[model samples]
Target: MSTKASRAAARLMISPSVILLLGWMLIPLGMTLYFSVLRFNLLMPGDNPFVGFENYRYFLTDPGFTAAIWNTLALVLGVLVITIFGGILLALLLDQPMFGQGIVRILVIAPFFVMPTVSALVWKNMFLNPVNGLFAHLFTALGLQPYDFLSQAPLASIIGIVAWQWLPFATLILLTALQSLDSEQLEAAEMDGATPLSRFWYIMLPHLARAITVVILIQTIFLLSVFAEILVTTNGGPGYASTNLTYLIYVQSLLQYDVGMGSAGGVVAIILANIVAIFLMRMIGKNLEA
Candidate 1:
């Protein structure tokens, strides 16, 4: 076959999947951009005016937007810290040769398979409930007032739930990376009188840097759009305490019936996602180059 014909055949084979993926991605985005330029309210289905950047201005100036941004940042950072540290510790522990290690590893990974809604519901009612929850029971036994977790510590509650779900993922990634480290390198470090801390810091951490970056990049993408846990637990309440950009956009589009503002928020979210993606690509590219 000629080179041109081979290329044509390859393109024909890939065209269906490429077109499908492109349609899935672009349809919603195109709709968002379209709605963003028009003053369309779901409740009032009538002649909508073309508003240009007015919706953007409204979304930007809204106080809720700032709060959502702050909450989103805090949630992402908090989850990252917990998952990274806890994952490393758990990975180290699991790497040991011990009895029933396989069972323990399965147990460790089980939480990641739990649905977000189920996890959130279990946490809110069975654990964090002020009235009939485990914490309430403990407080009652100790003669203390039951704490309202979702009401008072909504962000922390959401973070805890999200971290619990993500911990296994981070651990698995880091553990895989750990298992790939050169045993000879570790032996040499020990021979050089390197302490455990020094070996971990200089040898292990440096070796795992790429894996860590991958985990961070992937986690950040999911963490930025965390929604189901927050929806089930707090519903972005206690006056927008746990509201992130995703929830804020949800409220704008669904609850408020303001399509224009919601689309503007969607645009902002896309920009933020792209910024994070660019940074992650740069970081990974630099690591690959090194």
Candidate 2:
């Protein structure tokens, strides 16, 4: 077929999928927007009355909203910090030639494949239970009191859990980027009397800048929606201590049966996510250009 005809045929074939994808995305967004303006409480089985931006107002003004926003930010930043640093160290170690390198790399990356809920449960029950858990046992052996991680330190515990899950991903990405670095530069720098730290600070870090930006951008996107871990571990409790925006929305919609308020929260989350995404995209773009 002619080039134009072939292009037309390709478009025709893909149009259905494109339309379906649009519908799948736009339809729920439209519904959420529609509901966000009303007083649609599931418990109040009656005529749903439109209340303009009342739902948004209520959702925003709620005291938990502030705490949730802060917690969400903390979780994202904490996880990012841990994963990036831990991943860099791991990547550096994994890049070195060693016995059983393949198996070691596989083990390092294994956590990323585990389901979030499963990992959370494992951490909650096996590691952080405080009673008969691994940490508890270790503390007892060390002549210290067992710490209630999820209770006394709910937010931090969740951060640790999330960081553990994401560390492997960061390591894999950084390792790939590290491997691509020309080793000759490092050798040359070493021969020129550059210290190990100096070489890493100047050569290795600059090479990983793009990959690091990519990791942050992608991780921040998903980290904003973290829910299962909180649900499985703290349930956003000790009373909103670990409640990120996602859990707060879940509380409004499912627990309180206020669909409108939940939808408003969802919209708010989308806006925040988009803002962060745009900022990260620009940052990554600049990094790539450099």
Candidate 3:
């Protein structure tokens, strides 16, 4: 077939799936937008009257909304800081030759595969339980207090758990990038008496710059919407200590049975999420260009 004919045939083969995906996404969005302007509540089923931007006004004026925003930013920043620094150290360590290297790498990358709910449950029960958890036992043995992670430090604990889960992915990406670095340059630097710190700062870190930025951009997208961990662990308890925007939206939509308000929150979340995504995409594009 001619090139134009083949192009047309390729488009024909892909159009259905593309159209289906668009419909799937746009239909729910349209419904959400429609509902967001109404006064609908599942609990008080009556006339679902049109109330333009009233839902948005209520949702935005909510006291929890502000806290949720801060918590979301803190959570994302905490995870990014931990994962970027920790992943870099791990990548550097794993890059070195050692016995059982393959096994170590496997173990390092294993946490990324565990489901978020499962990992959060494990952290809550096995590690962070104040009574019979591993940390409690260790604290008791050391003659110290058994700290309650979920209660006392809900947001930080979630950050730690999330960072642990994402570290493997960051490590894998950075390791791949590190592996591509030219060895001869390092050898020359070493012969010229470059210290380890100097070698890492001057040679290695610059090489991993693009990979680090990529990891940050990708991880931020998912981290902002983190819910399962907060739900499973703290339930955003202690009065919104761990409640991010995602959890707040869930509470409004399901728990409160206020579909209109929930839809408003959803619309706000979509706007904020899109803004962040667009900013990150621009950064990624600039990095790629560089």
Regions more than 4 Å wrong, model 1? 1-3, 282-290
Error of 2 at 67 (Å): 0.9
TM-score, cand. 3: 0.95
Poorest 10 consecutive residues of model 3 by lDDT? 279-288
Model 1, total clashes: 0
- List ranges where model 3 is wrong by over 4 Å: 283-290
Q: Quote each prediction's TM-score.
A: 0.94, 0.95, 0.95
Give a tens-digit lDDT track for model 1, residues 1-290: 56998999999999999999999999999999999999999899988899899999999999999999999999999999999999999998998899999999999999999999999999999999999999999999999999998998999989999999999999999999999999999999899999999999999899888888888889999999999998888889888899999999999999999999999999999999998899788887887888
Ranking 1 against 2 by lDDT, winner? 2
TM-score, prediction 1: 0.94
lDDT of each: 0.94, 0.96, 0.95
Steric collisions counted per model: 0, 0, 0
Give the Å shift of residue 245 in candidate 2.
0.4
> Mind giving the per-residue lDDT tens digits that candidate 3 earns over 44-162?
98999999999999999998998899999999999999999999999999999999999999999999999999999999999999998999999999999999989999999999999
The 10-residue segment with the lowest total lDDT in model 2: 279-288
